[model samples]
Target: MLKNLEYLKSGNEKQRRAFKVINQLNMMEDLKIYSPILCGTIPLSIDTASSDLDIIMEVHDFSGFGDKINFLYGPFPQFKLKRKIIRSKLIVKANFIYDNFEFELFGQAQPVTQQYAYLHMVIEKYLLDTNPSWRCEIIALKERGFKTEQAFCHMLELTGDPYEALINYGLRKQII
Candidate 1:
């Protein structure tokens, strides 16, 4: 029932709605859902009216999984599909805007940085586990249009890659 993610259940109405969708999606046994780790402001429990859902999912087959999502969302009224180079490797990301939230899909074959970002979600979860005060700071940054990773870096006063900062956090805390 996605019980461990207590933040989502306690968030605002929009977050609850997003959680419903994610929970439903999580039940799809045919697909490799990968926990649907909530990213962005949603997981931080600081969802503003402008907040949108950011779910990072790992799938076995990108095309097949995307086709299923496209069929369900009906081609995403406003959608974008693109490729970005990360860590010297090209990774494709498909974004869909549904109910004013952004849903992003990343395949398992993505680059190192892309994979690291997903892994960062886990690290963020653990960090928030002990102290959630950073939620307020992150939400404010997100409202100003800073990306989730950027917000993490800025709030933590960490330099370089946000993923690396999180990795260091995990190392220091011995949570990895």
Candidate 2:
């Protein structure tokens, strides 16, 4: 987890702002949101200056909740935002100047639940170890056609126990 924090810190100013926005959103109690997958910046190599924030929020429900949440973010007066229902998820796209950020809220979704669980397990086991090599493995997996969330889930699936297969793969690829 420290490495992940470091990864965020290494990002440019806009990425750092995106991270702050995510933190603010997550800290909202009315949203009932959790398990934020801070995707775009950390894993996708999206430059802070050019990329939008991509975040997935796990929620218990999605009925009329997106608009309500969007309204709650009235603090950001200069931003233009839109909320739409996308399947079982509520998608929020907020833009200001040239910067865009997105939030996807998943409600009672099985895939979201599974992914969050897998992410939690993997982070708890591997990320806490502060291994730069493991971080490299994550980066490599992200580079290899896997979505940030998917790659992490795949790593969790492949290793069963954290730091074993992922670290080995990184070492073999000289990414560690």
Candidate 3:
């Protein structure tokens, strides 16, 4: 499912719509050079009405990437772009709304496989598939305003910075 967007076509209503919007915008082909992968709640079927589409990519050229995305999706409603450092690593992000689904394109110089979004999704999917009950529990936590990682951490009794803790758990369990 992570290798391509094809699975989304047969997923729930939201996933189908996500597939449409992504294709309609020619997102994959346009960003093909960067190797885009949609990673987040939608694919896991744990999303809420407010969940945004998170597309992660490996980008080496910030300037070129920013220029390309701005050219392609900049005209969309609420489109915005920014570059900032997170955990001391540079990242480029673009946000926009299309077909009522918020789209967040996150790019970092690191490999997509190494990005936190991708890693988290892999671990989250594993956990959700591990216990059917946890899916509802995690979603319930999300509805209560917990971020995905936070919800998972809370449910797992992980006690540190949720992000790092979850990743650490994944690493220890070889799940990420």
Candidate 4:
């Protein structure tokens, strides 16, 4: 059994196993996994405990297949798998055949230019300061329709400082 991030941080055996699995999974061709909570790209609230793992990948020639390919290719042979594909998103529900371990994968669409831009900005800023609070602020801004998260991420990527003016403007509005 794999431990969650909290236990992983404390160097528990389960954590080690989980990390090992993550590494192995990463090594698989055409797969990328990301967790905003785990990456500190978003606030770590209690809600993250039950969050499903999120992944993005370039499956070879998956343009038309999208979710279907994920459904067919994602599961281990022994696992009983259920899958759904909506637009570019793929959702899977499965239990490990051997251990009865339950897991899910939520696949997002291949990022568009806007999303890539947002992610780039976010990563740049995160690299500069690693401030979880700031990341949360960006997410909030995105949710509030200021811009796509990718756009914000891209802004940060380009300037390394974003939301400074916007944040101040918002603060002044609240005070007024």
Best by TM-score: 3
Residue 31 in candidate 2, Cα distance off native in Å: 2.4
What lDDT tens digits, residue by residue, belong to model 1 across residues 6-99?
A: 5666777776777677666562343335444445556656566765565555655656666766655546667665556767755556677765
How many Å off is the CA of 108 in candidate 3?
0.2
Q: For every model in order, what is the number of clashing pairs?
A: 0, 0, 0, 8
Off by over 4 Å in 3: none
Give the per-residue lDDT of model 3 (tens digit) for 1-176.
77788999999999999999999999999899998999999999999989999999999999999999999999999999999999999999999999899999999999899999999999998998888799888888899999999999998999989989999999999996
List where candidate 4 sits over 4 angstroms from the true fold. 1-17, 24-27, 30-47, 63-176
Judge candidate 4 at residue 171 and give its lDDT: 39
Query: What's model 1's lDDT at 135?
Result: 77
Score residue 121 of candidate 4 by CA lDDT: 34
Q: Report how far off residue 119 is in candidate 3 (Å).
A: 0.5
Higher-ranked by lDDT: 2 or 3: 3
Instruction: State model 3's lDDT.
Output: 0.93
Between candidates 3 and 4, name the one with more favorable TM-score.
3
Q: What is the TM-score ranking, best to worst?
A: 3, 1, 2, 4
Top of the candidates by lDDT: 3
**Model 1 Cα RMSD, Å?**
4.0
Write one digit per residue (lDDT tens) for candidate 2, span 1-176: 42243455566665576556655555334544444454443343422233344444555444454465556554553555565665455555444322245443333343443443334434433442544455557556656655444565474576443335554444454544
